[model samples]
Target chain A: MNATSCYETLGVVRDATPEAITAAYQRCLGELRASLNGPNPPPPERLDALRAAYQTLGNPAARQAHDAALSPPTPAVSADEGERRPYPFAFTGEGGEYFRIWIVNLFLSLITFGIYSAWAKVRRETFFHRNLTLDNSAFSYHGNPIAILKGRAIAVVLLIALSAAQNAGPFAYGIAVLALLPVVPWLIVRAFRFRAHNTSYRGLRFSFHGTYRQALTAFVGYGLLAAISFGLLFPLFYRQQRTFVLDNLRYGSAQFHCTASNGQFYGIFLKPIGLALAGMFAIGFLTAAGGAPKLLLPLAFGVGTMALMLFLLPYIRVRTTNLVWNHVSLERMGFSSKLAVLPYFGLLAGNMVLLLLTLGLYWPWARVRLARYRASCMSLLSAEALDSFVAGESANAAAVGDEVSELMDIDIAL
Target chain B: MIAADYFDGRSSRRHPATLGLRDGTVVVEGDFGRRSTALGAVEICTGADQTLSTIRFADGAMCEIRDSAAWAAELAGAGIGADAVAHAERRWHWALAALAGAVLIIAASYAYALPWIAGLLAPAIPQAVTQSISDTVLKGLDGGLLAPSKTSPQRQQEIAAKVAALAGPGQLPPHRLLFRAGPTLGPNAFALPGGDVVVLDELLALATRDEEVVAVVAHELGHLRHHHGMRQLLQSAVVSFVVGVYLGDVSTVVAGLTALLLESRYSREFELEADAYAGRLLLATPASIEPLIDTLLRLEQAHAKRRAADRGGLFGATDLLSSHPDTAGRVNALRAMKR
Candidate 1:
């Protein structure tokens, strides 16, 4: 009768044979049907009770338990209950932790004239690795942090090479620049592999097998569409971006299995539409304001919208990166996690506008949002717990500590 | 179990702790609970307080107390820890998407621009067109433009004979002329403009094969004719000049300029008047009526190729040369020959 009970529908004794149970269930259904056919049927209450009782004891384990309970001693807890593994981790708000790392990374990166990107990358990787946990089991960074640093260095080198090539003559430079078309996607795949290899949760490591060319082609193709359409095809472009990211993402040592609904998959398209509409409204409003008001409106809207968007940025991020694992295994982790376009564009546009207006004064705020955005992507319970522990220890510790000391502190005079 | 106990006791507090027996030699604890029996002095506490009672041997030795729990928690909280490491795969995918978007946009923009740009630069001499013209002109002038006529029977054959004679000695092969009806053929003896020109058979019928036909052909020879092809080319170059002034290196500049050019339309009628000039040349020639009539018939038949070439014939209002007189009426006037 209970909503949670799955075993009650079939009528059979705990020790009944499978054949006997099937026969009994069929007979009960027959009786119910015959009664309904008769002019005067059994009361609805009796039928409902019968149905509930049958539903409850239909499952093999529940039938056995019911039969056993009617006899003498109770049996051990059912395997169903015992087999239900608790979720290893929980979601904890660690925005501050994320904020701190982001700030430190930003500061270091700036101080070193962007030279610290390698170190920043390593630190960032380390921070994310330390925070992630599964079923109380924390992940360990077994691969060298230097690998991440190395990857960043490679990226920097490639970037420098591209910039140099771009400055070269049109023909030679164009070829060089075009040559980089494949490199970015390649680096992304490599970086993912490197990062995945470095990470392990409960001794299970993860890796990605995404192809650089496929990712590159999809991106280039969508970009072409956007350009050909004069940016009018942004919705389609955004959808492609989400699909490529989600479909390519993997988790666990064994790939995690995931299936996203059409609704969920295409939900990302709404973001661009929303942003465009918002941009249009903003521009229109500014235009209508006229003269001096118009000038200030853009500046005000730019700053205000940016700050507001930054605040909502985490939600957008969480929604986009919403990944559900069908079955995460020890050997391969396969999962589908979407990287939504809305949050990314929102973050980018917001930061760009702020940068334009404040002349880089908004960099810190942007950095904080960026950190939060990245952290939002991570699924780590322990990191959240640790964050809470830190916050709790700092916020109310004076009171709790004094009370604890009063109780535990021993006095030699006594 | 023994190691556990030893480690537990040794790690009881932050301060250094030691154990010994009755002898002066310090006793060292070994695995399996075995210990050396010797007397020794051991410092349990260096400077740190040893009074905290909660400190126990089972708790493991305290290394440096760095308050790094905050940093560790922050790292963990931000998914900078193992969890973040675990998610490195997803991050890579995200990066890939961003990269793909960038590349696609650039490539597509270039693809869309190619056809439009090509169309804009269409009038510029295609290498094929320039080469063909050069070959045709040089062959026609192979006799050094003022060569003494040994091949011709008369005192001086017309320019057509001279050029045809020169062509044979110069080793320049003549191009085949395929005729089709054109709307611009009139009393006019017209040149093919480039590559090859069709002379009207109607004009040829009006004059003797050698007299009127040769002179009419000479004018065309004057255009293919003495370096006129080169001069027409110069005029075309001047007319279709492109100012490659870039406003800025930005794509917006190119896009705006292209949009403006696409909206602008060119006027027709310029080519139609060129047909009239050909007619004036034919009138001055001493060619016969039969040759002129033959030229007209030939031109009427060959006009189709001109219509095919332009998509709109010279007489069609939308044609580029439509401003000139109708081809049919001009032919009628040429037929009424009073001269």
Candidate 2:
């Protein structure tokens, strides 16, 4: 038997044709399906493994990276090599450096009647990615601005249409809503693919393999369930989406696995809301006992609720980031996040104060600080070198999805 | 000699190689393979960082060079690609220059281009859309704070006839007069996008002369003639659009609130343009310019008195005297042209 990286995982030979790879993946899945039907259902874990392998091989970029790992060109002698130690991310970007680019981008984008915004997006993303380095290599972004502009046009048309419909009448709005419902899942899936396909580390591109059917179930199917349940079931949908996105992702051929459960996500969502309510109740009880004025009672309750939300916001963010990072792994290589609640909260509060105080002139500095904090908190731990894998699939994400959501002015929360 | 890493394009394998240029030939040697390609066969790229450069072979193989001065010099001399080192940005003051340039552009756009573009685009938008916007805004105001005018039907007719008289021959006014008791808007008279000139009872109470009320109607007519209301809306929308693109974080409700504030903001130019149009109209007619200037002064006093009377009212933002153009400037301009 061949050593199972991705090719061996799918029972394919090295240098397998694209059709052969597809056939192999299908054959593997079909065999698993047969075994389940024959009254001995293979464990879901085995099915997951097979799916990961299929995703890895199916993507051109991942397959290329996997093939390279299976056959290295030379022996390495590195000063840093010992046991695979955790590589901390370092951000070399100075705020001053970034501000110049920012001003130039802003100036050009302004003078061009905003047509240069697409190029600005590229420049901006590349600047941040290049500055955040790990393992002596920085990440790279490869997206065509022309493609993004095309996407922007599509997004604006869709946006104007929906907005016009909403302003026309409630019936027109309802019709537009019905028409857009099905496209949400499709857009979510496309957005995931677009972001992943353009991202590369160590010359190897990352790819997402989530299917349209999977996206539809995770987004719309569960969205309806949440709506039916008065939003209580939203955590289940969130977990489903994370799994759908994380599991299908392949950096080279090393699969990223996320095992966050519905309960964990629910805990994160409810903590802030529950605390705010409790705080309001406590303030109400205290003020009533103290014989406070009616106006003062409302003022106390409002301040209490606001404070509670402010405190819980960072708590939820920190814990949720932990849940995502600690549970996600590439093969056995895990991603660990050391983001603490108070420190993260400090960052958030400080960022807000800075933004308010500087009239937004300190925006570049704020961005740099946030990026630095996020990068510093995370580290990849593994025994194998990350650079050995390569993938060829360059799935150019339809820029329209990003621009569509952009025009809609909605962040697609996963 | 230059130390570089090679990727054959077909595989993810990294080969540590020494690169040297010899008589227009680029030679790369490593444990995996020794390959030579003509310097012209490889496309070179200058990277963002000074020392990071990449050369791509015709076969899609790539070589990344670090600290690549000698090889870069040779390739640059041959015009392989622009030298990254040569293209490195200027020190320190470039930021200052960029800041200056940005400020200059913003000032230019704010002072000249924004109004010009708004004026050009306002007419191109379908009249139907503007009408619908007007109808919707009026409907909202009516259901909330606006009641039908307390003024007698006879008084309303008098104002309407005066507006028609001001329109004179060959030029029909775009709007008809509408009156309401605007408890929320508070002593305001403004033209909606679809040429609806709404004058509240509070504003009418401030008018002491028949000529004063006629001047207000004439000013509102001027707004309709040049589509100033729609032009103002379009200009602010453009401002918000630019802000949205530049700032780029619209996911929050805060950003939407900011957009709301921006859209409501009327530029000083638009206010003056409407003022000029009114000034020219009033001067040409039997009505003198004094009524227009007097009405503006009275309107400011009416607003100031209202603010002083109730600071706790719905319209708490009474910094209007500072926000709008100095009423004195508009009056002076009108007076100078009257002579």
Candidate 3:
């Protein structure tokens, strides 16, 4: 008999596990192949039905939607009551624990002559991801080390080729650089896809759906202007790139949205520039008026620059983070970041001092401190419970793109 | 029994479940239903301290245990040790041992393996490539740092002839001599990758004897014979590549510094090789190795006086950072070779 539902097409029950569905699909495919090679081949309609069923049921989000379409709609509940409940994020990782992990990773990587770096990356990412908890559920990373290793190998080869070309001749060097330009956009998109697909929260995988064309427009087209403009048009570039990345991101079927405008990005960047200029003017005026001592001028300039340098990074970080998260929404749920610049600057300055004093032995502790503070500053604004979200399909992406971007020192951060 | 949150993997819904072992079978009981499988059939990812541990059933359902300590103790009570990797990562001593082992391996590789590999690989590079590279470097120097030779034509011709006679005739990949006036460089004789030996005017003006000029030329010839310039380039390339991979980013200031320090160490070995080569070459000629030694000492004393006058100017490379070996050690080695 011809089946009406995907469950019947797969010859499995509604409550069958993912493992059972996959097994049934494989068995049906094997039988279909056998019949095609036999005296009488099955109709194309049978092949269509099998493929359509698997496509719908293989993805958790699509299956949930399909099931909902089949069943009667349940009555809605008003859980919000015109108010949002804030669920604060937590990071449980410790410095001492991470230090041990880092040392072991470094040791294994060294002994293997960098072959183990792929595995080390996976383990380090796992440690960070699984320690980050939101609403009693920790995140997870599922990157394959073998894929990472293959990507790293390719990246190393490319790096060696580029360096060798420089020594070969000017013409060869130009050819090498020109050849790499077209692949840049593709690499950026693939890297985003790989990172997003491997990250999960509450069994629902995050996905990046940005294409190469969009990456070219956002990274290359906007990036060139930003570089040549000498920090004037950088805010617009930042906004465009952020929009390109965030707008295409999804958790299950819910799309992430960035509502922050270009003006907001400009506002964040300009505040520090204005402050630094004003500081220089004040210093100049005071020295010119003979109000400040001669010996104190250099000290004053040093202090002013140091203070500005410390304030500038955190100021932009806090503002952009708040601007992004405050305006970002995933379907019905929203996010909030109450990160203050002063405290973050203090923490960063302290971390830097400790890093220098300890000759970088304080790295693990510094990371933990920053993560904990940032997590403490972030919270999820959800009116409804998080359990209703469905898991999305994981896209196929290679690690080579991610490794190549990393080797090229591209900072694709949120 | 331990409490855990389970996901069937087909859906995002979480089911609060009780997990336990019943006669070698791992059972998961929740409001959704009961699922059981052989203990060995399941996959357990017991992470390090403070991190969550996950157990996956045969049906692709996963149970997340938040209380890792309790789960770990339960597994231990049931005669199951933690995963090998987590165990290794958890122990402090293992991490310490790994750090020590890494340091030893990196040090040994830097000391023995890198030079041997670079030396092996250098001769394989095409001459055309080296020629182009040398041409570019010479053009770059000529554009800014080097001026036309101000030495008189007679003196330059005579010294060049003497050096050519010392090098002998019919040599494959013959050396080409170039003269430049480098007031900034003081007295320096260097070899390029394409067998071009650049002798600065200051070097000739500083040398009292034609034998001293010939000795310096012989050393430059030694560098060409062994392909030392190409080998140095290859070695530095390898070092930076290794450092870049280790740090995962080439843009880091530390990586550049590390490459510089390592390259300097490798150059010291090359300097020694060149010294020995010049020594053997001089022994074959009427002149002894003494001119080479005297010229080196004089150059060192002149640089030392300049260093003191400027107190090692900001742009000036100090003796500690110099690529060449110390004059005293090099002279002692040359004397030992003569003996």
Between prediction 1 and prediction 3, which has the larger TM-score? 3
lDDT of 1 by residue, A299-339 (tens): 86687665555544554445545533222221112222334
Please write out the lDDT profile of model 2 over residues A1-414, one tens digit for every residue: 125577656665455557556766776787787888775687888777788888877888986776677765223535223454687777777776677668767767777878988987877777777677777666667677998888887887887899789868999999999999989777777777777777766566677778889988987898789899997897787677678888888775546789888778988888777866776787678776986666877687677766766776678667877898888976546777898888888987887788777767789888888788888888887666654453444445777776676667655543
Most accurate candidate by TM-score: 3
B68-182: candidate 2 lDDT, tens digit per residue:
4666577767666553222323244655665777789887876677777888888788879888999998998799778988999999998878767775675855676899997
Model 3, residue B200: displacement in angstroms? 3.5
RMSD of each: 25.9, 9.1, 6.6
Reported per model, the fraction of native interface contacts reproduced equals: 0.00, 0.27, 0.65
| lDDT, model 2, position B178 | 90
Tell me candidate 1's interface RMSD.
15.3
Q: lDDT score, residue B21, model 1?
A: 24
Model 3 Cα displacement at A91 (Å)? 0.8
Give the clashing pairs for model 3. Answer: none
- Tens digits of lDDT, candidate 1, B258-293: 433432221112222232333444554454344544
lDDT of 3: 0.82
Per-residue CA lDDT of model 3 for A1-414, tens digit only, reads 224888778766565557557767876788799889887898989888988888888899988887876653222335542567899999999888888888888888887878999999998888889889998888888799999999999998998899789967899999999899889999889888889988877666788989989999888888789899987888988888888889989775457899999988988888778887887899889989999889877997789877766777678878988999999987667899999988998898899888777756788899999999999999999876776664444457799889998888887867
